[model samples]
Target: MTTQVQSGGMVNTTLMGGGALLVVGLGLALANLMTGGHASFNSGSDGVTWGLPVVNYVFFALTSTGLTLVASLALTFGNKAFYPIAKRCVFLSLITLVAGFASLALELGHPFRMLFAVPLNFQVNSPLNWMGVFYAVFLVLGVLKFMKLHASDWDSDTSKQVGLAALVTECLAGGMLGMAFGAMAMRPMWYGTLVPLYFLLTAACTGGAFALLMTYLTYGSESAMPEKVRALVQGPLPAALAAVLGFTILVMGYQTVIGLWSNADGMQVWDHIVSTPWFWIEAGALVAAFYLLVSRSSLMVAAMLIILGLFINRYEFVIGGQLVPLFKGTWVAGMISYTPSITEWMLTVMAFGIVLAGWAFGEKAFNLSDAPKE
Candidate 1:
């Protein structure tokens, strides 16, 4: 009998879906906490302690960095096309940033220590320690920027200054994240100063792709998108996306070739990775994203593929880094295997759920529409 959907029905639907994800996520988290931290998980050995949590953390954190930087650039440049989505981008950044921290929390031996100890205890030399500090600063700046944009006019000089501050802090946070792992020379795959720079570029690509997708979803129709919005998505986004993809492909290809050629214990992990089904999935999604962007096909499809590819990349980066057991010089009998515990899967769902809830709430509360009414 109730065939007609009410106004804001879609938002309600998203809210409900997000709520379900949150419940499942929280329930599993509580269960894991009570049971004492992923005891059921098979992390292979001491060589592979980190798993899905690290992957999820890196994936969300990188995306957060991307969104914060993109939104700030939009504000700083005063590009009318990019202006409309700045607030949304900032809000999404905050959401993903918090989610990233949550994922990391789950991975920790004592998750509660993150709240106070992270701030009070200073490991000045550790990149990971510095990363936590940078993340906190980035979070504060994001919240400040979001509040400014939400409560005041977008054109205010104060907002621009806040945006700039947020941008600088985001770069610091993102760079520290990459360096946290890259500084580990023992893990040859992750080593190098170039890693931070690579993260910055990829963050741009991720942010651009994500913003484009959100634009398509929120605007409803092509006519709904302002001329400037169209230019932002169809112009800069595609070009940037293509270029970033090209660079990523080149780097990854070089890594793969060198890994195979070396056939050392560390590099030998690539042999196992290349043979896995996920490798093709990651490659296919990346190729599809590139093709869609270069061809100027469906921006939505391209965005989806890009996000998927990036997520898979995070998984491979984190997991593959530890697959080959580093037992002095002797090779292990078999490859280290890891399958995410149920709790890990639930937390991953919870992370995306938080993103959905934030997006829906932002749309509902801020009237995040492109209709030119506000």
Candidate 2:
């Protein structure tokens, strides 16, 4: 059973679980997509749809950037402590990046055009354009790096040099994603320039935690992040990451508070985020993450808290961004905002399923469980 688990059994399980989830999720998402577009979801009201779907995409994309960098750095930088956990992390990034794009495609009216014709059709300064270009560059660099790593016998030194440059580019692209949204004055809640900085920090925290979790689960105990690996990731990494997350939360909350005190609409949305159940939920996860990190618990406990904390942060970023309505010169509460329709939920589930399926299958099929001997 253990041999099979290390070989084909895991793949079979993932395919069964993730594959089924994907089919149902995508089916529902598609149905929702067909109905929502070509007409206002709000019945002639001109308001941007803000809710779970878009937030989910952002969470996935941002995480992709962080995960990619974390993985690539370990592989290429000769960081032995970090190396056992780097493999498949980049593959995971690529998978989730596709998921992000998939969610965004469902949300847009002309999703297909955004890939090609939209650039020629639209202007340069649009935030979407910046995001498009950044995503484009990351996508291209990702492919190039993948090819170089997998194509032929690139020696360790060469691979490291090339990987460093490519991953660095990916990081810049990832930071732009946050900057693009946060800089949008149209949404004052998102207008802080530090948004990029905030997002980048969270990405690292979550990405590290994710890598740690996968290391334990995918490989046996031998594959579990060793003391050295944990020291490297959860220690200095989290210590620094926590500072940054704390900073962003402080800055973000401060901005929200100031915005509310000064403006009517700001206050309404601020009230919603601060006073609602969601607010407490987000805060609780974040606080717990800190609790684990700061406390002298088992490394497993600390890593789990950090990972869950980051996940909760992702959820809040998605939902909170949309919770505050930027309408009527004053925000309104009591209106339950967008929930992922069943289809929307399914598509997301499917995307997740596909990733798990791929990861599990790859581990069995291709020896993804083994770290790069490089």
- Name the candidate that leads on lDDT: 1
Model 1 error, position 254 (Å) = 2.2
Candidate 2 C-alpha lDDT tens digits along 265-330: 433556656665766665666667566555534444555666555555555554555555556333
Clash list (residue pairs), candidate 2: 22-350, 25-346, 25-347, 28-343
Enumerate residue pairs that collide in model 1: 81-228
Q: Candidate 2: list runs displaced more than 4 Å.
A: 1-12, 35-48, 150-158, 220-267, 294-336, 372-374
TM-score per prediction, in order, is: 0.90, 0.79
Q: For candidate 2, report its TM-score.
A: 0.79
